[model samples]
Target: MCGGEQGCIETVKAALQGGVACIQLRAPGWKKRRLLELANALLALTRPAKVPFLLDDEVDVALACGADGVHVGQRDLPVQTVRDLMGPGALIGLSASNSAQIQQADVAAADYLGVGPVFATQTKTDAAPVLSPEGLATLKALTEKPIVAIGGINHANIGVVAATGVSAAAVVSAICGQPNPLASTQQLAAAWQAGVK
Candidate 1:
Protein backbone atom coordinates (compact mmCIF):
# COMPACT_ATOMS: atom_id res chain seq x y z
CA MET A 1 0.00 0.00 0.00
CA CYS A 2 2.16 2.87 -1.22
CA GLY A 3 0.66 6.31 -0.99
CA GLY A 4 0.60 9.46 1.05
CA GLU A 5 0.33 8.78 4.76
CA GLN A 6 -3.34 9.67 5.09
CA GLY A 7 -4.28 7.66 2.04
CA CYS A 8 -2.45 4.65 3.34
CA ILE A 9 -4.12 5.01 6.73
CA GLU A 10 -7.57 5.22 5.18
CA THR A 11 -6.90 2.18 3.04
CA VAL A 12 -5.72 0.27 6.10
CA LYS A 13 -8.79 1.32 8.04
CA ALA A 14 -11.02 0.06 5.28
CA ALA A 15 -9.15 -3.20 4.96
CA LEU A 16 -9.36 -3.76 8.70
CA GLN A 17 -13.09 -3.05 8.61
CA GLY A 18 -13.28 -5.60 5.84
CA GLY A 19 -11.63 -8.19 8.09
CA VAL A 20 -8.09 -8.57 6.82
CA ALA A 21 -6.38 -11.19 9.01
CA CYS A 22 -3.16 -9.22 9.36
CA ILE A 23 -1.68 -5.80 8.62
CA GLN A 24 1.89 -5.22 7.43
CA LEU A 25 3.29 -1.70 7.18
CA ARG A 26 5.63 -1.39 4.18
CA ALA A 27 6.84 2.17 3.81
CA PRO A 28 10.40 1.84 2.69
CA GLY A 29 11.11 5.44 1.70
CA TRP A 30 9.37 7.33 4.46
CA LYS A 31 11.46 9.06 7.10
CA LYS A 32 11.68 7.36 10.46
CA ARG A 33 9.47 9.91 12.18
CA ARG A 34 6.81 9.60 9.52
CA LEU A 35 7.03 5.84 9.50
CA LEU A 36 6.72 5.72 13.25
CA GLU A 37 3.65 7.93 13.11
CA LEU A 38 1.98 5.66 10.58
CA ALA A 39 2.94 2.57 12.52
CA ASN A 40 1.43 4.01 15.67
CA ALA A 41 -1.76 5.01 13.89
CA LEU A 42 -2.05 1.56 12.39
CA LEU A 43 -1.39 -0.05 15.76
CA ALA A 44 -4.24 1.92 17.26
CA LEU A 45 -6.50 0.23 14.75
CA THR A 46 -4.97 -3.26 14.62
CA ARG A 47 -4.53 -3.86 18.34
CA PRO A 48 -8.21 -3.36 19.00
CA ALA A 49 -9.20 -5.59 16.11
CA LYS A 50 -6.93 -8.36 17.37
CA VAL A 51 -5.15 -8.36 14.03
CA PRO A 52 -1.40 -8.81 14.03
CA PHE A 53 0.50 -5.72 12.89
CA LEU A 54 3.84 -6.28 11.18
CA LEU A 55 6.38 -3.78 9.88
CA ASP A 56 8.11 -4.63 6.62
CA ASP A 57 11.91 -4.25 6.76
CA GLU A 58 11.65 -1.61 9.44
CA VAL A 59 12.80 -3.32 12.60
CA ASP A 60 13.53 -0.05 14.34
CA VAL A 61 10.09 1.40 13.76
CA ALA A 62 8.50 -1.92 14.59
CA LEU A 63 10.35 -2.18 17.87
CA ALA A 64 9.66 1.44 18.68
CA CYS A 65 5.97 1.08 17.92
CA GLY A 66 5.77 -2.28 19.66
CA ALA A 67 4.34 -3.91 16.56
CA ASP A 68 3.31 -7.53 16.75
CA GLY A 69 6.45 -8.33 14.76
CA VAL A 70 8.40 -7.67 11.57
CA HIS A 71 8.63 -9.12 8.07
CA VAL A 72 12.05 -9.16 6.41
CA GLY A 73 13.08 -9.86 2.86
CA GLN A 74 16.06 -11.92 1.72
CA ARG A 75 18.49 -8.99 1.93
CA ASP A 76 17.19 -7.56 5.19
CA LEU A 77 18.38 -8.61 8.61
CA PRO A 78 18.74 -12.34 9.12
CA VAL A 79 15.82 -14.14 10.78
CA GLN A 80 17.73 -15.17 13.91
CA THR A 81 19.02 -11.64 14.44
CA VAL A 82 15.51 -10.21 14.12
CA ARG A 83 14.20 -12.86 16.48
CA ASP A 84 16.90 -12.00 18.97
CA LEU A 85 16.17 -8.28 18.79
CA MET A 86 12.40 -8.56 18.78
CA GLY A 87 12.35 -11.39 21.31
CA PRO A 88 10.98 -14.93 21.02
CA GLY A 89 7.33 -13.96 21.08
CA ALA A 90 7.64 -11.67 18.09
CA LEU A 91 6.22 -13.01 14.83
CA ILE A 92 8.95 -13.00 12.19
CA GLY A 93 8.27 -13.47 8.49
CA LEU A 94 10.84 -14.14 5.77
CA SER A 95 10.42 -13.81 2.02
CA ALA A 96 11.35 -16.82 -0.11
CA SER A 97 10.74 -16.69 -3.87
CA ASN A 98 12.27 -19.92 -5.11
CA SER A 99 13.51 -23.37 -4.23
CA ALA A 100 17.07 -22.38 -3.37
CA GLN A 101 15.87 -19.52 -1.20
CA ILE A 102 13.38 -21.77 0.54
CA GLN A 103 15.95 -24.52 0.98
CA GLN A 104 18.36 -22.02 2.47
CA ALA A 105 15.83 -20.19 4.65
CA ASP A 106 16.03 -20.38 8.43
CA VAL A 107 12.61 -21.96 8.63
CA ALA A 108 12.77 -22.59 12.37
CA ALA A 109 13.33 -18.94 13.15
CA ALA A 110 10.64 -17.50 10.90
CA ASP A 111 7.05 -17.88 11.99
CA TYR A 112 5.92 -17.85 8.35
CA LEU A 113 7.23 -17.60 4.79
CA GLY A 114 6.03 -14.89 2.37
CA VAL A 115 6.36 -16.60 -0.98
CA GLY A 116 5.72 -15.00 -4.29
CA PRO A 117 5.45 -12.57 -7.01
CA VAL A 118 2.96 -15.44 -7.60
CA PHE A 119 2.49 -13.50 -10.79
CA ALA A 120 4.35 -10.39 -12.02
CA THR A 121 4.06 -7.35 -9.75
CA GLN A 122 4.51 -3.61 -9.87
CA THR A 123 4.26 -3.03 -6.15
CA LYS A 124 7.84 -3.91 -5.48
CA THR A 125 9.94 -2.89 -8.44
CA ASP A 126 12.81 -5.01 -7.20
CA ALA A 127 10.75 -8.13 -6.43
CA ALA A 128 12.29 -11.35 -7.55
CA PRO A 129 11.26 -13.31 -10.62
CA VAL A 130 7.65 -14.37 -10.80
CA LEU A 131 6.69 -17.63 -9.10
CA SER A 132 3.62 -18.93 -10.83
CA PRO A 133 1.09 -20.92 -8.80
CA GLU A 134 2.93 -24.15 -9.58
CA GLY A 135 6.16 -22.69 -8.29
CA LEU A 136 4.41 -21.45 -5.18
CA ALA A 137 2.99 -24.90 -4.44
CA THR A 138 6.34 -26.57 -5.07
CA LEU A 139 7.89 -24.29 -2.49
CA LYS A 140 4.95 -24.84 -0.15
CA ALA A 141 5.62 -28.58 -0.21
CA LEU A 142 9.06 -27.89 1.22
CA THR A 143 7.95 -26.15 4.40
CA GLU A 144 5.38 -26.55 7.13
CA LYS A 145 5.38 -22.87 7.97
CA PRO A 146 2.39 -20.79 6.97
CA ILE A 147 2.69 -19.29 3.48
CA VAL A 148 1.55 -15.79 2.59
CA ALA A 149 1.59 -15.29 -1.19
CA ILE A 150 2.46 -11.77 -2.22
CA GLY A 151 3.21 -9.65 -5.33
CA GLY A 152 0.76 -8.71 -8.09
CA ILE A 153 -2.05 -10.57 -6.30
CA ASN A 154 -5.45 -9.06 -7.03
CA HIS A 155 -9.12 -10.06 -7.04
CA ALA A 156 -8.98 -11.64 -10.49
CA ASN A 157 -6.17 -14.04 -9.55
CA ILE A 158 -6.45 -14.37 -5.78
CA GLY A 159 -8.76 -17.36 -6.08
CA VAL A 160 -6.14 -19.22 -8.07
CA VAL A 161 -3.42 -18.25 -5.62
CA ALA A 162 -5.63 -19.31 -2.72
CA ALA A 163 -6.38 -22.59 -4.48
CA THR A 164 -2.67 -23.31 -4.32
CA GLY A 165 -3.12 -23.79 -0.54
CA VAL A 166 -1.27 -20.73 0.63
CA SER A 167 -2.30 -19.63 4.12
CA ALA A 168 -3.07 -16.11 2.88
CA ALA A 169 -2.75 -13.77 -0.11
CA ALA A 170 -1.11 -10.37 0.34
CA VAL A 171 -2.41 -7.69 -2.00
CA VAL A 172 -1.35 -4.12 -2.72
CA SER A 173 -3.08 -2.57 -5.75
CA ALA A 174 -6.20 -4.69 -5.40
CA ILE A 175 -7.21 -2.93 -2.24
CA CYS A 176 -4.98 0.09 -1.64
CA GLY A 177 -6.00 2.11 -4.68
CA GLN A 178 -9.45 0.73 -5.17
CA PRO A 179 -12.51 2.94 -5.13
CA ASN A 180 -13.76 1.07 -2.11
CA PRO A 181 -11.09 -0.90 -0.29
CA LEU A 182 -13.69 -2.40 2.04
CA ALA A 183 -15.72 -3.89 -0.77
CA SER A 184 -12.61 -4.95 -2.66
CA THR A 185 -11.33 -6.73 0.43
CA GLN A 186 -14.70 -8.38 1.01
CA GLN A 187 -14.82 -9.68 -2.56
CA LEU A 188 -11.23 -10.92 -2.45
CA ALA A 189 -11.81 -12.53 0.93
CA ALA A 190 -14.81 -14.34 -0.46
CA ALA A 191 -12.83 -15.48 -3.48
CA TRP A 192 -10.08 -16.80 -1.25
CA GLN A 193 -12.60 -18.65 0.93
CA ALA A 194 -14.22 -20.22 -2.09
CA GLY A 195 -10.89 -21.25 -3.52
CA VAL A 196 -9.72 -22.81 -0.25
CA LYS A 197 -12.92 -24.85 -0.15
Candidate 2:
Protein backbone atom coordinates (compact mmCIF):
# COMPACT_ATOMS: atom_id res chain seq x y z
CA MET A 1 0.00 0.00 0.00
CA CYS A 2 1.01 3.65 -0.40
CA GLY A 3 2.69 5.33 2.57
CA GLY A 4 -0.04 7.94 2.70
CA GLU A 5 -2.09 5.52 4.78
CA GLN A 6 -5.22 7.40 3.86
CA GLY A 7 -7.59 6.56 1.01
CA CYS A 8 -5.26 3.73 0.04
CA ILE A 9 -8.15 1.42 -0.80
CA GLU A 10 -9.66 3.94 -3.16
CA THR A 11 -6.22 4.41 -4.70
CA VAL A 12 -5.91 0.64 -5.19
CA LYS A 13 -9.38 0.47 -6.81
CA ALA A 14 -8.46 3.30 -9.14
CA ALA A 15 -5.21 1.63 -10.17
CA LEU A 16 -6.96 -1.66 -10.93
CA GLN A 17 -9.41 0.17 -13.16
CA GLY A 18 -6.54 2.07 -14.73
CA GLY A 19 -5.00 -1.15 -16.08
CA VAL A 20 -2.43 -2.27 -13.57
CA ALA A 21 -1.99 -6.00 -14.18
CA CYS A 22 -1.55 -6.76 -10.50
CA ILE A 23 -1.88 -5.14 -7.09
CA GLN A 24 0.09 -6.08 -3.96
CA LEU A 25 -1.40 -5.09 -0.60
CA ARG A 26 1.58 -4.15 1.59
CA ALA A 27 0.74 -3.21 5.15
CA PRO A 28 3.77 -4.35 7.09
CA GLY A 29 2.68 -3.32 10.61
CA TRP A 30 -1.04 -4.14 10.61
CA LYS A 31 -2.57 -6.87 12.73
CA LYS A 32 -3.06 -10.21 11.00
CA ARG A 33 -6.83 -10.17 11.41
CA ARG A 34 -7.05 -6.64 10.10
CA LEU A 35 -4.91 -7.54 7.12
CA LEU A 36 -7.09 -10.56 6.43
CA GLU A 37 -10.22 -8.42 6.44
CA LEU A 38 -8.63 -5.95 4.04
CA ALA A 39 -7.46 -8.77 1.85
CA ASN A 40 -11.01 -10.11 1.66
CA ALA A 41 -12.27 -6.80 0.40
CA LEU A 42 -9.42 -6.41 -2.09
CA LEU A 43 -9.88 -9.95 -3.35
CA ALA A 44 -13.46 -9.16 -4.25
CA LEU A 45 -12.30 -6.09 -6.14
CA THR A 46 -9.61 -7.99 -8.07
CA ARG A 47 -11.10 -11.43 -8.74
CA PRO A 48 -14.04 -10.39 -10.93
CA ALA A 49 -11.69 -8.29 -13.05
CA LYS A 50 -9.37 -11.23 -13.60
CA VAL A 51 -6.45 -9.29 -12.17
CA PRO A 52 -4.07 -10.96 -9.72
CA PHE A 53 -4.05 -9.73 -6.13
CA LEU A 54 -0.88 -10.02 -4.04
CA LEU A 55 -0.23 -9.61 -0.34
CA ASP A 56 3.07 -8.23 0.86
CA ASP A 57 5.00 -10.16 3.55
CA GLU A 58 2.25 -12.54 4.70
CA VAL A 59 1.65 -15.89 3.06
CA ASP A 60 -1.05 -16.72 5.59
CA VAL A 61 -3.15 -13.72 4.59
CA ALA A 62 -2.55 -14.50 0.94
CA LEU A 63 -3.84 -18.05 1.44
CA ALA A 64 -6.59 -16.97 3.81
CA CYS A 65 -7.97 -14.51 1.27
CA GLY A 66 -7.34 -16.91 -1.58
CA ALA A 67 -5.29 -14.15 -3.12
CA ASP A 68 -3.41 -14.61 -6.34
CA GLY A 69 0.00 -14.25 -4.66
CA VAL A 70 2.25 -12.64 -2.09
CA HIS A 71 5.47 -10.60 -2.21
CA VAL A 72 8.03 -11.36 0.46
CA GLY A 73 11.15 -9.50 1.47
CA GLN A 74 14.41 -11.35 2.11
CA ARG A 75 13.95 -11.30 5.88
CA ASP A 76 10.14 -11.39 6.09
CA LEU A 77 9.68 -15.06 5.27
CA PRO A 78 12.07 -17.46 3.64
CA VAL A 79 10.93 -17.91 0.04
CA GLN A 80 11.13 -21.68 0.31
CA THR A 81 9.01 -21.75 3.40
CA VAL A 82 6.35 -19.55 1.81
CA ARG A 83 6.44 -21.58 -1.37
CA ASP A 84 5.98 -24.79 0.55
CA LEU A 85 3.07 -23.30 2.45
CA MET A 86 1.36 -21.97 -0.66
CA GLY A 87 2.00 -25.08 -2.78
CA PRO A 88 1.76 -25.25 -6.56
CA GLY A 89 0.45 -22.50 -8.84
CA ALA A 90 0.68 -19.95 -6.09
CA LEU A 91 2.55 -16.81 -7.17
CA ILE A 92 5.43 -16.07 -4.82
CA GLY A 93 7.21 -12.82 -5.62
CA LEU A 94 10.57 -12.10 -4.05
CA SER A 95 12.16 -8.76 -3.35
CA ALA A 96 15.65 -8.67 -4.77
CA SER A 97 17.30 -5.32 -4.11
CA ASN A 98 20.77 -6.32 -5.11
CA SER A 99 22.57 -8.74 -7.38
CA ALA A 100 23.46 -10.87 -4.35
CA GLN A 101 19.86 -11.22 -3.24
CA ILE A 102 18.80 -12.04 -6.76
CA GLN A 103 21.52 -14.62 -7.01
CA GLN A 104 20.48 -16.19 -3.73
CA ALA A 105 16.81 -16.52 -4.80
CA ASP A 106 15.32 -19.91 -5.48
CA VAL A 107 14.12 -18.96 -8.94
CA ALA A 108 12.22 -22.19 -9.50
CA ALA A 109 9.88 -21.32 -6.63
CA ALA A 110 9.37 -17.68 -7.46
CA ASP A 111 6.81 -16.33 -9.90
CA TYR A 112 8.66 -13.05 -10.38
CA LEU A 113 11.30 -10.82 -8.80
CA GLY A 114 10.96 -7.25 -7.57
CA VAL A 115 14.22 -5.45 -8.42
CA GLY A 116 14.34 -2.14 -6.70
CA PRO A 117 14.36 0.64 -4.89
CA VAL A 118 15.37 1.75 -8.38
CA PHE A 119 15.87 5.10 -6.76
CA ALA A 120 15.53 5.84 -3.06
CA THR A 121 11.94 5.80 -1.77
CA GLN A 122 9.94 6.87 1.23
CA THR A 123 7.50 3.98 0.98
CA LYS A 124 9.93 1.72 2.79
CA THR A 125 12.54 3.96 4.35
CA ASP A 126 14.64 0.94 5.16
CA ALA A 127 14.93 -0.19 1.50
CA ALA A 128 18.34 -1.14 0.30
CA PRO A 129 20.59 1.18 -1.65
CA VAL A 130 19.26 2.28 -5.04
CA LEU A 131 20.09 -0.18 -7.78
CA SER A 132 21.71 1.32 -10.81
CA PRO A 133 20.87 0.20 -14.36
CA GLU A 134 24.08 -1.75 -14.65
CA GLY A 135 23.38 -3.67 -11.46
CA LEU A 136 19.82 -4.38 -12.56
CA ALA A 137 21.03 -5.50 -15.96
CA THR A 138 23.52 -7.78 -14.26
CA LEU A 139 20.74 -9.42 -12.26
CA LYS A 140 18.48 -9.59 -15.30
CA ALA A 141 21.17 -11.43 -17.20
CA LEU A 142 21.27 -14.06 -14.47
CA THR A 143 17.57 -14.97 -14.39
CA GLU A 144 14.64 -15.62 -16.70
CA LYS A 145 11.78 -14.54 -14.48
CA PRO A 146 10.19 -11.22 -15.41
CA ILE A 147 11.41 -8.52 -13.05
CA VAL A 148 9.19 -5.83 -11.55
CA ALA A 149 10.97 -2.59 -10.65
CA ILE A 150 9.67 -0.65 -7.68
CA GLY A 151 10.55 2.32 -5.44
CA GLY A 152 10.46 6.02 -6.30
CA ILE A 153 8.72 5.26 -9.58
CA ASN A 154 6.38 7.73 -11.25
CA HIS A 155 5.28 8.87 -14.71
CA ALA A 156 8.22 11.23 -15.06
CA ASN A 157 10.91 8.57 -14.60
CA ILE A 158 9.03 5.42 -15.61
CA GLY A 159 10.53 5.50 -19.08
CA VAL A 160 13.97 4.89 -17.64
CA VAL A 161 12.70 2.01 -15.51
CA ALA A 162 10.76 0.40 -18.38
CA ALA A 163 13.79 0.55 -20.66
CA THR A 164 15.42 -2.06 -18.42
CA GLY A 165 13.08 -4.52 -20.24
CA VAL A 166 11.55 -5.93 -17.09
CA SER A 167 7.92 -7.04 -17.16
CA ALA A 168 6.28 -4.38 -14.99
CA ALA A 169 6.85 -1.50 -12.59
CA ALA A 170 5.30 -1.42 -9.11
CA VAL A 171 4.15 1.99 -7.98
CA VAL A 172 3.00 3.52 -4.70
CA SER A 173 2.66 7.28 -4.21
CA ALA A 174 2.47 8.02 -7.92
CA ILE A 175 -1.05 6.70 -8.09
CA CYS A 176 -2.07 6.76 -4.45
CA GLY A 177 -1.35 10.34 -3.51
CA GLN A 178 -3.27 11.99 -6.31
CA PRO A 179 -6.52 13.85 -6.23
CA ASN A 180 -7.71 11.71 -9.15
CA PRO A 181 -6.07 8.36 -8.64
CA LEU A 182 -7.62 6.74 -11.70
CA ALA A 183 -6.25 9.41 -13.98
CA SER A 184 -2.85 9.29 -12.31
CA THR A 185 -2.70 5.54 -12.63
CA GLN A 186 -3.77 5.69 -16.25
CA GLN A 187 -1.04 8.20 -16.94
CA LEU A 188 1.60 5.93 -15.41
CA ALA A 189 0.28 2.86 -17.24
CA ALA A 190 0.30 4.72 -20.51
CA ALA A 191 3.80 5.89 -19.81
CA TRP A 192 4.96 2.38 -18.98
CA GLN A 193 3.38 0.92 -22.11
CA ALA A 194 4.82 3.59 -24.32
CA GLY A 195 8.27 2.97 -22.89
CA VAL A 196 7.97 -0.80 -23.45
CA LYS A 197 7.46 -0.25 -27.19
Candidate 3:
Protein backbone atom coordinates (compact mmCIF):
# COMPACT_ATOMS: atom_id res chain seq x y z
CA MET A 1 0.00 0.00 0.00
CA CYS A 2 1.17 3.61 -0.73
CA GLY A 3 1.19 6.13 2.14
CA GLY A 4 1.00 9.96 2.26
CA GLU A 5 -2.64 9.66 3.28
CA GLN A 6 -4.38 9.44 6.61
CA GLY A 7 -4.85 6.07 8.36
CA CYS A 8 -2.27 4.48 6.07
CA ILE A 9 -1.46 1.74 8.55
CA GLU A 10 -5.11 0.73 8.62
CA THR A 11 -5.25 0.83 4.83
CA VAL A 12 -2.17 -1.37 4.70
CA LYS A 13 -3.81 -3.92 6.96
CA ALA A 14 -6.89 -4.04 4.75
CA ALA A 15 -4.77 -4.46 1.62
CA LEU A 16 -2.85 -7.26 3.28
CA GLN A 17 -6.15 -9.00 3.96
CA GLY A 18 -6.70 -8.95 0.21
CA GLY A 19 -3.38 -10.74 -0.40
CA VAL A 20 -1.04 -8.07 -1.68
CA ALA A 21 2.31 -9.68 -2.41
CA CYS A 22 4.26 -6.88 -0.76
CA ILE A 23 3.86 -3.53 1.00
CA GLN A 24 5.83 -0.29 0.48
CA LEU A 25 5.81 2.49 3.08
CA ARG A 26 5.83 5.90 1.37
CA ALA A 27 4.51 9.06 2.96
CA PRO A 28 5.89 12.20 1.40
CA GLY A 29 6.38 15.29 3.58
CA TRP A 30 6.29 13.38 6.85
CA LYS A 31 9.08 13.46 9.40
CA LYS A 32 11.44 10.52 9.71
CA ARG A 33 10.19 9.60 13.18
CA ARG A 34 6.63 9.22 11.97
CA LEU A 35 7.79 7.26 8.93
CA LEU A 36 9.78 4.95 11.16
CA GLU A 37 6.79 4.36 13.40
CA LEU A 38 4.69 3.49 10.39
CA ALA A 39 7.39 1.21 9.07
CA ASN A 40 7.62 -0.59 12.41
CA ALA A 41 3.87 -1.11 12.48
CA LEU A 42 3.99 -2.44 8.90
CA LEU A 43 6.82 -4.75 9.79
CA ALA A 44 4.65 -6.13 12.53
CA LEU A 45 1.91 -6.81 10.01
CA THR A 46 4.05 -7.99 7.06
CA ARG A 47 6.23 -10.35 9.07
CA PRO A 48 3.34 -12.58 10.09
CA ALA A 49 1.95 -12.52 6.57
CA LYS A 50 5.39 -13.26 5.13
CA VAL A 51 4.98 -10.40 2.67
CA PRO A 52 8.00 -8.27 1.92
CA PHE A 53 7.91 -4.82 3.48
CA LEU A 54 9.75 -2.09 1.52
CA LEU A 55 10.53 1.51 2.35
CA ASP A 56 10.63 4.15 -0.36
CA ASP A 57 13.82 6.25 -0.80
CA GLU A 58 14.87 6.27 2.85
CA VAL A 59 17.92 4.17 3.45
CA ASP A 60 18.14 5.28 7.05
CA VAL A 61 14.53 4.40 7.74
CA ALA A 62 14.95 1.03 6.07
CA LEU A 63 18.05 0.37 8.11
CA ALA A 64 16.54 1.65 11.34
CA CYS A 65 13.44 -0.49 11.01
CA GLY A 66 15.14 -3.40 9.28
CA ALA A 67 12.84 -3.17 6.29
CA ASP A 68 13.01 -5.84 3.62
CA GLY A 69 14.57 -3.21 1.35
CA VAL A 70 14.51 0.32 -0.01
CA HIS A 71 13.26 1.53 -3.37
CA VAL A 72 15.38 4.36 -4.79
CA GLY A 73 14.95 6.59 -7.84
CA GLN A 74 17.35 8.15 -10.34
CA ARG A 75 17.81 11.34 -8.29
CA ASP A 76 18.28 9.37 -5.09
CA LEU A 77 21.44 7.55 -4.07
CA PRO A 78 22.92 5.07 -6.53
CA VAL A 79 21.80 1.43 -6.29
CA GLN A 80 25.30 0.32 -5.44
CA THR A 81 25.46 2.73 -2.55
CA VAL A 82 22.18 1.45 -1.17
CA ARG A 83 23.35 -2.12 -1.50
CA ASP A 84 26.53 -1.32 0.34
CA LEU A 85 24.55 0.38 3.08
CA MET A 86 22.01 -2.42 3.42
CA GLY A 87 24.46 -5.20 2.68
CA PRO A 88 23.51 -8.54 1.05
CA GLY A 89 20.00 -10.05 1.42
CA ALA A 90 18.46 -6.63 1.83
CA LEU A 91 16.57 -5.70 -1.34
CA ILE A 92 17.20 -2.57 -3.43
CA GLY A 93 14.93 -1.28 -6.16
CA LEU A 94 16.01 1.49 -8.52
CA SER A 95 13.95 3.61 -10.88
CA ALA A 96 14.76 3.14 -14.58
CA SER A 97 12.83 5.54 -16.81
CA ASN A 98 14.49 4.74 -20.12
CA SER A 99 16.77 2.29 -21.90
CA ALA A 100 19.84 4.24 -20.88
CA GLN A 101 18.83 4.24 -17.24
CA ILE A 102 18.15 0.52 -17.41
CA GLN A 103 21.53 -0.15 -19.04
CA GLN A 104 23.34 2.00 -16.52
CA ALA A 105 21.73 0.57 -13.37
CA ASP A 106 23.84 -1.92 -11.42
CA VAL A 107 21.50 -4.88 -11.68
CA ALA A 108 23.75 -7.05 -9.52
CA ALA A 109 23.30 -4.52 -6.74
CA ALA A 110 19.56 -4.03 -7.23
CA ASP A 111 16.90 -6.66 -6.69
CA TYR A 112 14.33 -4.91 -8.91
CA LEU A 113 13.56 -1.77 -10.87
CA GLY A 114 10.54 0.51 -10.47
CA VAL A 115 9.76 1.62 -14.01
CA GLY A 116 7.38 4.26 -15.32
CA PRO A 117 4.33 6.21 -14.58
CA VAL A 118 2.60 3.56 -16.68
CA PHE A 119 -0.53 5.64 -16.91
CA ALA A 120 -1.26 9.25 -16.01
CA THR A 121 -1.28 9.58 -12.18
CA GLN A 122 -2.36 12.17 -9.68
CA THR A 123 -0.81 10.57 -6.59
CA LYS A 124 2.73 11.45 -7.60
CA THR A 125 2.57 15.07 -8.72
CA ASP A 126 5.98 14.86 -10.35
CA ALA A 127 5.58 11.43 -11.94
CA ALA A 128 7.39 10.73 -15.18
CA PRO A 129 5.58 10.56 -18.50
CA VAL A 130 3.02 7.80 -18.91
CA LEU A 131 4.45 4.62 -20.44
CA SER A 132 1.20 3.00 -21.58
CA PRO A 133 1.35 -0.77 -22.13
CA GLU A 134 3.51 -0.59 -25.23
CA GLY A 135 5.99 1.74 -23.64
CA LEU A 136 6.10 -0.50 -20.55
CA ALA A 137 6.82 -3.50 -22.76
CA THR A 138 9.64 -1.62 -24.45
CA LEU A 139 11.24 -0.82 -21.11
CA LYS A 140 10.72 -4.36 -19.81
CA ALA A 141 12.64 -5.75 -22.77
CA LEU A 142 15.61 -3.53 -21.95
CA THR A 143 16.53 -5.25 -18.71
CA GLU A 144 16.58 -8.60 -16.99
CA LYS A 145 16.06 -7.05 -13.56
CA PRO A 146 12.59 -7.64 -12.15
CA ILE A 147 10.47 -4.63 -13.20
CA VAL A 148 7.76 -3.27 -10.94
CA ALA A 149 5.48 -0.89 -12.87
CA ILE A 150 4.69 2.14 -10.74
CA GLY A 151 2.52 5.29 -11.08
CA GLY A 152 -1.15 5.36 -12.13
CA ILE A 153 -1.55 1.59 -11.97
CA ASN A 154 -4.93 0.38 -10.74
CA HIS A 155 -7.47 -2.42 -11.18
CA ALA A 156 -8.87 -0.94 -14.40
CA ASN A 157 -5.58 -1.07 -16.32
CA ILE A 158 -3.49 -3.54 -14.33
CA GLY A 159 -4.31 -6.34 -16.77
CA VAL A 160 -2.95 -4.36 -19.68
CA VAL A 161 0.17 -3.50 -17.71
CA ALA A 162 0.54 -7.16 -16.78
CA ALA A 163 0.29 -8.10 -20.45
CA THR A 164 3.46 -6.08 -20.91
CA GLY A 165 5.13 -8.64 -18.61
CA VAL A 166 6.15 -6.24 -15.90
CA SER A 167 7.24 -8.27 -12.88
CA ALA A 168 4.81 -6.45 -10.59
CA ALA A 169 2.46 -3.46 -10.37
CA ALA A 170 2.88 -0.75 -7.74
CA VAL A 171 -0.15 1.36 -6.88
CA VAL A 172 -1.01 4.45 -4.88
CA SER A 173 -4.68 5.49 -5.18
CA ALA A 174 -5.78 2.11 -6.46
CA ILE A 175 -5.51 0.33 -3.13
CA CYS A 176 -4.23 2.84 -0.61
CA GLY A 177 -6.77 5.50 -1.56
CA GLN A 178 -9.69 3.14 -1.90
CA PRO A 179 -12.50 3.06 0.61
CA ASN A 180 -12.31 -0.71 0.39
CA PRO A 181 -8.63 -1.50 0.04
CA LEU A 182 -9.22 -5.25 0.26
CA ALA A 183 -11.61 -5.24 -2.67
CA SER A 184 -9.25 -3.10 -4.69
CA THR A 185 -6.39 -5.43 -3.93
CA GLN A 186 -8.43 -8.49 -4.87
CA GLN A 187 -9.30 -6.95 -8.22
CA LEU A 188 -5.70 -5.99 -8.83
CA ALA A 189 -4.51 -9.47 -7.95
CA ALA A 190 -7.01 -10.99 -10.35
CA ALA A 191 -5.81 -8.73 -13.13
CA TRP A 192 -2.19 -9.56 -12.32
CA GLN A 193 -2.94 -13.26 -12.73
CA ALA A 194 -3.83 -12.59 -16.38
CA GLY A 195 -0.44 -11.21 -17.29
CA VAL A 196 1.90 -13.15 -19.60
CA LYS A 197 4.57 -13.33 -16.91
Candidates' TM-scores? 0.96, 0.93, 0.94
**Over the stretch 1-197, how does candidate 1's per-residue lDDT look in tens digits?**
54687898898899999989999988777799999998999899999999999999989999999999999999899998999999999999999988887878476799999998899988788989898998899999998889999988888889999899889999888999789999999999998888884
Which numbered prediction scores highest in lDDT against the true structure? 1
Comparing 1 and 3 on TM-score, the stronger one: 1
Better candidate by lDDT, 1 or 2:
1
Tens-digit lDDT track for model 2 on 22-46? 9888877799998898888878888
Predict model 3's lDDT versus the native.
0.85
What residue pairs are clashing in model 1?
none
Off by over 4 Å in 3: 1-6
Model 3, residue 96: what's the lDDT? 79
Worst 10 residues of 1 by lDDT: 99-108
TM-score of decoy 3 = 0.94
Evaluated against the true structure, the overall lDDT of model 2 is: 0.82
